[model samples]
Target: MRYNIIHRTTYKYESPVTVGHYMARLEPRTLPFQECPWHELTIFPSPIERAERSDYFGNTNVYFEIEGSHQKLEVIARSLVEVIRAQPFDPASTPPWETIRDSCRSDVYNPATPAGELTFASTLIPVGVPYADYARPSFLPGRPILQGVCDLNRRIHRDFVFDPKATDAATPVEKVLKQRRGVCQDFAQVMIACLRSLGLPARYVSGYLETVPPPGVVKLVGADASHAWVSVYCGEVCGWMDADPTNDVLPSERHITVAWGRDFADVSPLRGVTTGAGEQRLKVAVDVLPDKD
Candidate 1:
């Protein structure tokens, strides 16, 4: 499946004063099952300086700086991507959850393991007893890791309430678990916490989820929004399989991956420090349209 995605972010500030620098992680990645051959970023009040670089996790990150006074800021990104389902994986055939867990905790001398780096707590998610407790029900003794993770995914989908107003980016996982409410980001983080607390390797995924309208119905422009999901390392055979606890589905052609990391802080689409604009209002509009060609 192929798609054309447009993401627009607009910021209107209360007052204008000076300089601003921003970083964006809006480019989709090309992996064995996904390909991102073309993408672009457009910024209003064109920046005085800009550069692109790959971060520690290998995600494409672009930075730009605006030198004078500006009361408003606007950034837009466009991407064309193709997603293909990978080889079939058998959850029951995967190694027991404990095996992969141990591999992830191996020695520092071991060849750098991406899964290992994600097994512990990070900037936003912290390993804790509560997280383990929440995950224990699905992880039975010697259970195949993927099988157990599927159960955990469904449980999260069934348990939480999606409320955008309930929490912000800064909201902690502990609070979301307590309130049982949050957006996709909250669910993804909570799931990561649960996996890590159980000594398993899991990462947060940020991207776009295609929203289909009813048959013959017109699709609304800018109706889609950025999405977050979870990816668990189910041993070496399964590698990373994407799961969307928020929507209770495994990511497939409808899900387009951008960047991933230990938590949202690592892959936020846009973030930066500005010398001006004391207070600001942010509006984000996203459209993920199927490309006819």
Candidate 2:
């Protein structure tokens, strides 16, 4: 399947005086099952200096600086991508969850291997007794890793409510766990915390998910929004598998990959700093449309 994605962000400052610098991780990734042939980032009141590079996690990042003062700033990213659905596999066929945990524990530390690095705590995700206890039920002794992960994913979906206003980027994982309500970001972080607490490698993924309308209903432009999910390291043979606890299913063609890291802080879609600014109003609109050509 082919898709055209548009993400637009605008910030209006009550008082603008000086410089601004920003970093964007909005480019779609190219994976074995995904291809991005075109992409472009447009900034209003073009920056004085801009550069592109790959981050520690191999994600494409764009950095730009604006020296002139302005009351409004707009950043838009457009891309065309093709995604192939992964073939389904039996979760029971995966190795035991304990074995994978042990392997991560015993393996030598290697930054080149993200799976090992991801097994420990990160900025937003914490590993503690509470998280391990919460995840222990699904990962009983000798349970297949993927099977246990899937069960945990389903349990989260069944237990939590998707409330957009319940949490913010700074909200701790412990709070989300206690409240049992949040948007996709909260669910993904909570799941990551659970897996990492048990010595499992799980990364936070940021991207877009196609939202289909009801039968015979026309899709609304800008109705789609950014999405977050988790990717588990299932072992050498099976490799990384994406799971959407927010939707309770394995990601497929409908899920477009953007960037991933230990947690959302590492791969936030957009982050920046301003030299002088007062109250700010921000607006974001996203569209993920099927492409025909």
Candidate 3:
């Protein structure tokens, strides 16, 4: 499926900013499952200096500096991407949860992926009392699919509320789980942390959400918005399965990939530092339109 995405962000300052800087991670990367045909960005009152580089996590970073007093700043990003993701429901010969767990041991669990990336660490994802107790040896390994790393994805959907204002980017996973409310980013992070606690590799994903309109109704334009999810490596055959605990669904034709990384900090669409700006307000708007072809 193909989509044309338009995203605009504007910043207003109470006082004119003499100097400002920003880091942008809006470019999409080509993966085994997705493709990027064209992508570009434009900033209003163009900055005097700009630089681009790739972060450690493989996300593209655009940095810019603006000099001279300015009351407002605007950044616009547009992209046309052709995404071809695999169907989650595709039948395979992989063993079920029971057979897989029986062949695996708790001590042998490691969260590193085949590529040698540490997908999860204890510091990032601590195992709570309930989680540790539930995975003990006395329990029936096959029966407690809810005890291990794989269960983090489903547990989040079953336990939390999709509250947009419930938390912010800095909120911790324990807090999110305790409150049982947050947006897609929050849910994705919690899942990432939980999976890592259980020694599994997980990563955060950023993209666009495709809205499904009622029958016979044309999909609402601009109704679509930015979305976040998590991808966990579930062994050799299953590879990485994208899960959206916020919506309790898998990535389909509707999910458009923009970027991915270990966490939001690694793939935030826009972030940066500034000088001479006492305070600033930000406004953002996103539109996802289906291609006619």
- On lDDT, the leading prediction is 2
**Span of 10 residues, lowest total lDDT, candidate 2:** 106-115
Q: Tens digit of lDDT per residue, candidate 1, span 165-222? A: 9999999999999999999999999999999998888999999999999999999998
Off by over 4 Å in 3: 89-116, 121-152, 214-221
Q: Candidate 1: which stretches are off by over 4 Å?
A: 108-112
Candidate 3 on 147-210: residue-level lDDT in tens? Answer: 3333445567877888878887778767876788999888887777665544445678898886
Query: In lDDT terms, how accurate is model 3?
Result: 0.69
Q: Judged by TM-score, which candidate is best?
A: 2
* Total clashing pairs for each candidate: 0, 0, 0
lDDT of 2 by residue, 84-134 (tens): 976966899998998888777775653325577788899889999998999
What are the TM-scores, per candidate, against the unseen true structure?
0.96, 0.97, 0.82
Clashes in model 3: which pairs?
none
Supply the global lDDT for candidate 1.
0.91
RMSD of 2: 1.6
Which is better, 2 or 3, measured by TM-score? 2
